[model samples]
Target chain A: MSERVVAAAEEGQVVELRRSGRRPRAVANGVRAAAILVALVVLAVFPLVFSNPAVTTIAFFTLVFMTSTTAWNGFAGYSGYIPLGHAVFFGTGAYTLAIVAQDLHMPGGYGVFWLVPLAGAAALVVAIPFGLIALRTRRHTFVVITIAIFFIFQLLSFNLGITQGSSGIQTPTPPWFGGAFNIPFYYVGAVILVLSIAVSWFIRRSRFGLQTLAIRDDEDRARGLGVQVGRVKLVGYVISAIPVGMVGALYAYFIGQIFPQSAFDPLFDITIALMAFLGGLGTVSGPLLGALVLEPLQQYFTVSDPSYYLIAYGALFLIVILALPRGVVPTVGAWIGNRRARRAAPSPAAAGEASGGAPGGTRYAATVRSGE
Target chain B: MALLEMEDVRKSFGGLQALSACSLEVEEGSIAGLIGPNGSGKTTLFNIVTGYERIREGAVRFRGTAITNSTPERVFALGIGRTFQLTRIFTRLSVVENMLVATQRHEGWLRSVLRPAGSASEHRRAMELLDFVGIARLADAPAGTLSYGQRKLLDLACVLVADPSVILLDEPAGGINPTLIGLLAQRIRELNRQGKTFLIVEHNMEFVMSLCHRVTVMDFGKTIVSGPPDVVRSDRRVLDAYLGTEEADGDEAP
Candidate 1:
């Protein structure tokens, strides 16, 4: 019976090992499409289900955090350029919107809704010069420089008084949205969150995405192969900054205030980086997973035991990094893939024969030959 | 006229002179071999010409255009493609994706944003390159999973995708299996037939002699010899450099 099963598997006939009749390539693509569809559906329905005022408020905050984290993930996870001071972009967007809305008195929602993206554009403009200097340095050095930029901007915001100095500005809520503290704001936040995720997903599969992966894997090799490493990375940094800026603007409107310390918080940067790392650095679903899993823990900590929460979050990060360096998604994905591969096979010999007959079989044979 | 010329190129790393006035010329459409013992500055010369290392006191001219101190991207844009001694592939990407990266396309941030979902031409071209290298079956396989030989072929395919006029292959068959070496030799010949100029740095005498039309030998950051394969093989200096005194005597006896 085992022999018959093995023969059938090798022959590509009726076998338990066959996951689907569709090609493996098609199946993998199908899985990705389904995941995107599911995420879109969830985002659309989230605000309706959580009708409570408090729940809506928390959801809004979560969405903002998600947007910033997703943007951070694009550079840190995909391109391997760790921006330790990403709060600069976030703060820039927030302040730009704040100054325009509060001091200049740009129509209320115009500042929160429209000007936020404009702030993102300003961040992009800043990113060009910053990238030229920052990207020239190595990874750790770039991180340090990014951190310094954050400090510099934070100091500027405090001293200039344009952003209301240390006291910060009080942004007005748009009248159409029924003030900052409303359920409708939750829907707006959801839109931003969904848009951020969609744009990130789009970039990940695009030609630029391929180039970024190439750059991440080996910058020198990518350059040698005709990839414009500097330009590619600069664009990635700029794109990442936009969403972060939008999130900051939203945060300011939601709370009706913006402080230098709050806007340029190191904790927010660390949280986004930690969330991205915890979920899976290079996977599309990583940021979302990280946010979804950790945000609740954060809320619980803030409510139940605020003091211990910091320690808990830090410890969790350390534990996750030490235990699963590839982040949760990749580690779990690999585990599931391996498990499937194992369970589908009755014995090692049968499995070998089946694999030897598969599409990767010839390459495997070539690899073995090269090994010798 | 020489298609590419390096005139007394000099490079130093702090106290060590990596290239001491090293100079050589590669004629258009010719397969030029650069051979030297370990730490003999062959790679330094390649690096200087390819713009990876700066030349301190010499000029590098390609097709009568000065390219000394140019960036690697500029060099690549000028139709010079190179492969490393140890293959450097985009490990996580599919084989086809690796090839697509080498193809020239409008890659600005805006263009990427507005670019269509699927690129049939790019895909077809990448597949054609893969087929040329005999790795079409592995087109969808992640490059990291490929064997060393396959990776070498993929690397070659990537360079070819750039549609370069000149290719610098650093030790193409350095650590490959004997079977793959034969394949590499055949491919090099096939590519040469298509009018692509090659500057190869290899240690395998048999492979080098069989593939290269002319050989340029280097030692101690200077050109030791430059001639056709037969002339180079018979040169006493070539024998002395490759075999040393004791080994030269062994070869002389045989």
Candidate 2:
């Protein structure tokens, strides 16, 4: 009932549809949310029960990728600015954590975990200048600029004295032992993941988020409508950097090394962008879903057969993207929405067939738009 | 009192001059019409007023304060709103979202981002405007699904949501059916009666002549005449400009 059909049929007054559809959709959304909560709870205890180093390691990296991808989506998804060099902030956070931990003379273990949020703060600072410069451009140019800036950071990390270059700065090891060692990182990563999702959820519904979406759709129009397009884009870009930066710091602690190669991975940007694209570019659940499916499979395949993993992974990505060009969440969402709309309507054909030849882009957009 | 004034504005694109020396004034609480041949710089003038373009030599004033070279959103914040020659509503946003984003009327700057996209009052107001425009039932649907006329209506509604004191509408009657055009004219008259100001750029002379309090005619990037609609309608210069420009004011769907 909550499904608002995009049918342009003037057959009858549509005012009644809004009244009937509201409550049912709300209940359905609540139920779906509850189910996801239960699933997240069950997934959180995975490392505790499995305790296998290999398994827990995969779980930990999955959480990291999920968090980073979702954070990336916060800006790129809404703003349509694909920042291919997000690792600039990611690297900055890693270096910041390493430098701060050393200068503070802090002991290793759970204490370093407290600095994860600090890592996010550091990323925010770097992002402001990066965003100011990069957000001025549009579309593919913006992507190219981000990639260019990324290389600059990568070079700095290699050449900078404080970063320790090839020697690689070391993070103090966790004082724990055995298979249980990965457990702490896994849980902490999980916590970061939850926090990132909560933040993302808020932004999706916020007025800022709507403005960002407007920017994505039409920057000039958004500007004419009184949106501070530049400010909104910059804020989205900066906000996206926080989780990635924090994840990078957490990653450094887990690996016990802050090598430029590991911390400022060029592949990192591609992977997160691909993940978000595969699941859904702008929707909240799309990135999380994409990360969940892709990251673990990526980790497992790399471990099981490193050579064939890339080939197989590449094949899968191509197939999914080609089959669902709009991405899985949106494609599937449109189908579900169409189905429900048909059910809700008095006449079956008016819901879908009547809206036939409505452009595919419009259907996808209709499915993704948060009507409430 | 002059609500918006542009003085001897000159704008050029590369070698061609779009606005040679165009000047205009819109009085408070009056509906003003800007009509010109195609490429006669009507839209360019609107662009400069909304801060989308920077004039080579000109001063734009809103309420006697210079606003030259200000940003577009800043211009809007200063109580001027504009619509495009081609309707530019966000295609992916819901019809209501199109209205709500213009609710910068609610927040001053970046503060609105922290608030929920729709408050009870804001949603109520958005829905009311949508209903006023006769698209209230379509509010929950993505705006892309709207027909061309509907999108034009939505564009106007989006601008009105900001409650700007002055609105610049470029071709509000273009491409829509005559019925919808009449509805649009009626709405504009009603809004103007309530003390809102309008600066409309239109090729539909009948709509402009019937609806506008004053008409400003442009030819070759210059304001040839400005006066009551009936006076400008029969002016020899206005007649020559239209005939010389291949009768560009004819019904040409943009």
Candidate 3:
């Protein structure tokens, strides 16, 4: 039966080659690598080309949100956890960096910069117990537990004397970057964004990632299939926390202060969820695309009209959820794939699929009948 | 000594007892069938042995090591594989990917990340297993696209991928056509001849009587009889257990 598929392919007819989706083409890989290289070069020269502090600041904020959103998507989107408390790690990172710089009285240069990863480590360590406890609860309960944890951390920041009783911790400047430290910070944000993308890509291709998707699809079946469900989830949560924490540490250094309100802000969680969902949850590029589109719109709205942006944000989320639940990338991706399949072999297989007559065509009808 | 043994195993859900002091043994290199009417606790016993359910009192021993409270993954790691009655295959994954995920060998997270799911050897093995189940053409298909009988074959192939010492199949022939049932029976016999032990929960008495080396009957969460198929088939206690049940028809023919 497949020999005929090969014959059709040889005659330049589309055979619907593989059942799941299109195979990864070498040309696509090349195109992707070139795109990343070009993006890196452009970002590397961004601060140099535009000396405007406002431009650099906007870029920094965009990158920061991008990093955090991608990190949140790593575990939550992929595993269908939908965490509403990633601010826990972000705030932890911010406070940890602030406390370390203040108490240790560390001078900048590489000395203070070296402590950034330690801040991330702090978040990762904290996430272990928190993730284990939170992940025990399924979807809705998990979201509530995460919110509870976020609030607990926020309250801790407010009451703890070491956090300066919510007045905020003033961060020390890195001594190496002479003037306009925002440029160096922009570069830091870019590096973190790249790392986020890299980690996301790695997870998407890994066996660990497959296990996560299986858990997302059906947790009990994943366990029955021999996946250590809890352990894998904790690992995902911990991996997610590290990047958010690192970005938080960098944000604190850029802003030069940390407070319970800003650091543990629920708005951050909202933005992360919106960004990931907007781009395409579970896809590696989804969160990145989402962050790029929404963050600048959000910043523009906040600058122009603060009250309206919140309303717009809520409205936009509702629209996306209602209309394009799979997000932009996957929806558009599937459309393009179907178009190509139709163009390649305009009538045969597609007609069979529509009519539910071909060998594997029943799936399409089942999908429609099931309304999933 | 048995390869898999459950001694006085007890399990309850809320106020309802599911398994009441159920004792059973599956010896090495033998095919055993667990036949019972609906709600007879056959699945509960399988769940308990596979660590999906915990036994209240009594021990489940795999190769002589007590593994009563082990997690599902832990039990799988200990070389006891199982299939679900409702077919728990990863529907979103490709058929080959589903097989690959069940590979018993553990890979470090870093290694897994660096190595793509399309490694040559794993792909070959996955394809081999898919072909072994007579669905090699569907290897690249999303498992959700498979027909019901094809999904059952995929489920069986998944358990076999781990190469475990003992496999517990929950209704391998239920809802399958006669042709596929014959194919499945042949495959089970072929695997058993190769020294793989099987404990099957089935309502198809013909399939059980013809393929199983031994058959055990259960009713109301209690083991009624365990012996050669002919002995168990003619036993008065076993007959009474199925007297008013739908399964009486299955026993009557064979």
Q: Which candidate is the best by DockQ?
A: 2
Give candidate 2's chain B TM-score: 0.94
Superposed Cα deviation of residue B154, candidate 2 (Å): 1.1
Q: Which prediction has more favorable TM-score, 1 or 2?
A: 2
After TM-score superposition, what is the CA distance of residue B134 in candidate 1 from its true location, in Å? 2.2
lDDT of 2 by residue, B107-224 (tens): 7445766788888998999999999988897786677767788888899999988899999999999988888899999999999998899999999999999999999999999999
What CAPRI grade goes to candidate 2? medium
Q: What is the DockQ score of candidate 2, to 2 decimals?
A: 0.53
lDDT of 1 by residue, B125-147 (tens): 88888888878866755676676
Give the higher-TM-score candidate: 2 or 3.
2
DockQ winner between candidates 1 and 3: 1
Per-residue alpha-carbon lDDT of candidate 3 for residues B40-62, written as tens digits (9 for 90 to 100) = 99999999888888766999998
Overlapping backbone residue pairs in candidate 2 total: 2
Model 2 CA deviation exceeding 4 Å by range: A6-23, A348-366, A369-372, B106-110, B245-254
Error of 1 at B153 (Å): 1.2
- What clash count goes with each model? 0, 2, 0
DockQ of each: 0.42, 0.53, 0.38
